[model samples]
Target: MEAIDGLIHGFGVAFQLQNFAACLAGVFIGNVVGVLPGLGVMTAISMLLPLTFAMPPVAAILMLAGIYYGAQYGGAICSILLNLPCHPPHAVTCLDGYPLTLKGKGGTALGVTMLASFLGASFGIVLMVFFAPYLVRIALNFGPAEISSLMLLGLLAGSTLARGSKLKGMSMTCLGLLLGTMGTDINTGLQRFTFGFPELDDGLEIVALALGLFGVAEFLKSVNAVAPVSTSATRIRIADLWPSRSELRTAIVPALRGTLVGSLCSMIPGTGPTIASFMAYGLEKRVSRRPQEFGHGAIQGVAAPEAATHAAVQGDFIPTMSLGIPGDAVMALLLGALVIQGITPGPQLITEHPDIFWGLIASFWIGNILLMVMNMPMIGLWVKLLSIPYRYLYPSALFFVCIGVYSVRSDMFSVGTTLAIGVFGHVLLRHGFHPAPILLGFVLGQRFEENLRRALLLARGDLSIFVTRPISLAFLLTAVLLLGAQLYFALRRRDEIQLPPSASPILDE
Candidate 1:
């Protein structure tokens, strides 16, 4: 009943002209962003963050949220038609999507992808509708100790679960924490890590860091890299778009399973849409009787991963909104946006600012519908986007990055900082180090530190305070177990690698 009432109130807010326009603009840009190779949704959102300063908080959030999931709809277009994954989450789609294209069923693959994307997003939205409110209620019981422990768990999970070397991820996370410490200590008036630069007193501008790492750095890395071209992609016809009834029936179970996988992944910190899509594809292959068809134009391959990606993308908001714990880098950026807008995210968010929460949820339904309608009719246009030269795209995108960073403080220092970080980020990218974990660490580090300080203060510096509280102890234990499991797996794998060939049953066989 509450959910129903909230939805009704939400629709009233979403229908407002300004908010509606923001959602439309966001989804449209997101679609284009997703169709363009090398430009991620994170980069797009980061670049646009400064622009939201003048907008209403609810509308700003609606727009940014639109971009995140709307990208899911457009990503498969490139993956299916041109064998390119504009979005990382859709990379798995390229396996079967491109094969179907080669077999002249690219339209069919796209149709299935679209259907799966819609269904997956719908499922995620429904889950959030009923789940987030209850989560908020449970979180209201948490105290400083529990909050701090939970934050520690989030940091650890994000670092370890990010897509890279766990050691490197942890190192980057520590680096982020160090960066977060650059500003004056909240409790103490003394400054640290300023290095005598007055600009450092306020700490690093998130706009600079986000734009530098995700936007400018990506542009620098992808500037010279060439994308594979597909001539047949230009020939897609509306008539060839729909799959047969049998294929639709075949896709239903996998799509549902993928949605389930994505929803579950969303609840776990650090795992996001990209992981969900890959896991879904793997699951589908294992369950299929004709597993051999998986990479050879399997409809299940197109459906499952696309479904999972959309589902996970939408579900990613649950943790961010309900617990104030961002599940991934993108969600962290969104959280920053909320902070900038003066809207605190957490259990009290639903009560204090129900408009932002419910309105954003309502916008999801509206945006997804718009995406579905726009994508099907405009498939040809998106395919044509593949023909656009990288030279034209990267430079244009960098221009916006520079402008956005500069706009934040109207200072050249921010632009220079962005460039410096971009160069460093490019170096990291070259060495196979992901910058996402860094952003996660940087965003969550402050909250962790603050909560830890408060918790200690409440306990009069007693370390046992954490363990005395069952919830706090549980979170700490989870963090420890996560690290232990990763260590155990690492050592086990190393041992297996070092075993003598004669001692292996596989070698004897």
Candidate 2:
């Protein structure tokens, strides 16, 4: 009954004219940004965050949340039509989507993507509505030791699961933690890594770092890439938009499976949509009767990953809102936005600010509905956008990146910091180091340190308090188990590779 009443109140708040306008504008901008390469939700949000400083908290959050999820809807458009992914999660869609486009079934593939995305987002939102409150209740029982342990687990999971070498990921995470330690110490009044800069008192600006690492770094990469040339004229007619009954049937089960996978993965901090989408695609391929059809335009291939990506993104809000733990870098930015608005996110957020929490939830549904309605009709528009040359697009994006970072503090130092970070990020990219784990580490580092100190203080400087608390102990054990499993699999793979090839003994046997 309490949840029901809260939702009803949320509906009332979301239905307000100003909030509705904000939602519409946010989704519209998000969709447009998602259609364009070299610009993503993180960049868009970072650029627009300063503009939201004067708005009401609910209205500000509603808009930013819209952009975050609406981009998922838009990302699929380019992946299916142009073989170009606007976001990392959409990259999986390109494997099957482009092949389908080449087969002259682009319209069918896109239609399936739209349907799957809608269904996936709906499933995730429903899960969030039910599970977030329970999670918050459980989190309310947690003290500093448990919270610190949980954050450590999140960091370990992120580093271990990130693509490429775990060592590199761990290294990046450590770097991020080091960077996070800059500026004034929370417990003590002294500065740690300020390097004598007065601007470093508040710590490194998150807006500057985000714009540099993601926004500017992405722009630099795009600038060096060859502009795609469209030689053949691909016309998608309205008549070709509807999927055949058989195709629709083929996509249903995979979409459901993807939704389930995505919803579950989203609850885990540091796991994002890209992992969910890839996992969904891999699962579908493994279980299908014709695994060979995956890269060759399988409808299930298009449906599953697209669904999972959207669902995973929506599911991320669960941890971000309920436990004040961001699932990924994008969610970290959202968390920062909340703090900037003077609203703290945690277990008490719901009770203290029901309007913000419930209103944001209600707005998510509205934003998804708006995305579904906007996607199909605007297909032609988005497809047209793909034809525009990169040379034209990147410059405008770079301009925004510079201005956004500068506006954060009305200082040139932030812009210079963005440039430096962008160069460093480019170097990192060249060396196969992913920026996600680093960003997550930086975002959570402060909280982890704070809680660690608090826990020790509470326990009279005894480290055993972490092991003595049941919740903290459980989280640490889970982290150990996960790390052990990863190591075991890695060693097994190495052993398999080192083993000598079987000789003619098999033939003799």
Candidate 3:
């Protein structure tokens, strides 16, 4: 009943002219952004954040939210048509999507992806509507100690579970925590790590950091990479875009299974759409009678991952909104945007500003419908978008990166800061380190520190406070278990590598 009433109020808010227009514009831009290879949702949102300073909080948030999920719909286009996964989450789609294109069933694959994406997103949105309100109620009971312990769990899980070497992810996370400490200390009013620079008092701009690491760093790496060429695959007919009844029957079950996998992954920290999509694809292949057809244009291959990506993308919002704990870099930026708007996320946010909370939820239904329309009838328009040359696209994007950075403080120094960070980020990429964990750590570190200090002060400086409370103790134990399991796996894999070839079980087989 509470959800129903809140949703009713939310629809009223969402129906306003400004909010409606914002949602439309955001989805449209996100569609274009996703179709482009180098420009990711992170870059699009970071660049556009400054521009939303004057917009109403509800409208701004609605627009930004649209971009996040809207990109999911657009991401499948290039993967199926050009064998290019512009978004990392869509990379799994290329395994089967491109194969479908080679077999001249690209349009059919896209039809399945569209159906799966809608079904997946709808399932995720319904989960949020029912789950987030209850989650917020439970989170309200968490004291500083519990919150601190939970955040520690989030940090550790994010680092260890990220798609890379655990050691490297941990290193990047530590670096971000160090960066988070650079600004003035709120409790003591004493500056730390400012290096005598006045701007460091505010620490690095979130916009600058996000644009530098994701936006400019990706640009630097992709600048020299060859652009995908158009082939006969681009000549897909509109009539072929609709799947046959047989193909639809083949896709339905896998799409549902993928949605379930995605919803589960969304609830877990550090496991985002990229991981979920791959997991769904692997799961489908394992369960299928025709596993041999997985990489060679299986319809299940196209349906499962695409559904998982959409479901996970929508489900990512639940933790960010209810717990105020972002699951990934993209969610971190959205959290930052809310903070900038003077709207604190977490349990209090839903109660204090029900309009923003429910309105955002309502807008999801609207945005996803709009995305379906655009992806279907306008498929040709996006196919044409693939022909854009990299040379013209990147330089133009870099110019906007600089401009967006400059717009924040009206200073050239911020722009320079972005480029410097970008250069370093590119260096990290070259060395096989991901910058995503860095953003997650940076965003969560200050909150963790603040809660730790508060819990310590309340407990009269006793470190045992974290273990005394049952919730806090449970969270700590979970983090320990997670870390231990990861280390055990790492060691087991290492030992397997060290085994002599003749002594290996495979040799006996």
Whole-model Cα lDDT per candidate? Answer: 0.90, 0.86, 0.90
- Candidate 3 per-residue lDDT, tens place, 54-163, comes to 89999999999899998888889998888888988999999999999889899999889989999999999999999999999989999999999989988888889898
Error of 1 at 452 (Å): 0.3
Tell me the spans in candidate 3 whose CA falls farther than 4 Å from its real position: 499-509
RMSD in order of candidates: 1.9, 2.9, 1.8
Q: Candidate 1 residues 1-509, lDDT tens each? A: 99999989999999999999999999998998888888898999999999999999999999999888877788888888888777789889999999998998999998888889889999999999999999998899999999999988988989998887999999888988888898799999789899999988988988899999999888888878866566553588777788899999999999999999999999889999989999999999989999989889999999999999889988999989989999999999999999999988999999999999999999999999999889878988887877788878888889999999989889999999999999999999999889998888888888889999999999999999999999999999999999999999889878887888776534321
Residue 291 Cα positional deviation in candidate 3, in Å, after optimal superposition:
1.0
Runs of candidate 2 exceeding 4 Å displacement: 229-232, 496-509
Name the weakest run of 10 consecutive residues (lDDT summed) in model 3: 500-509
Model 1's TM-score against the true structure: 0.97
Q: Is candidate 2 or candidate 3 better by TM-score?
A: 3
- Clashing residue pairs, backbone N/CA/C < 3 A, model 2: none
lDDT of 2 by residue, 1-509 (tens): 67778788998999999899899999998898888777878879878877788789999999999998888888887888888887889999999998999999999998899889889998988887788899899999999999999989988887887778887888888888888999999988899999899999999888888777887877777677746746255667666778999999999999999999899889777679989999999899989999888898999999999889889988999988988888888898898888888888889899999999999888888888888788767777777876688878788878878877777789999999989998998888888887767777888889889999999999999999999999999999999998898899899778877766772222321
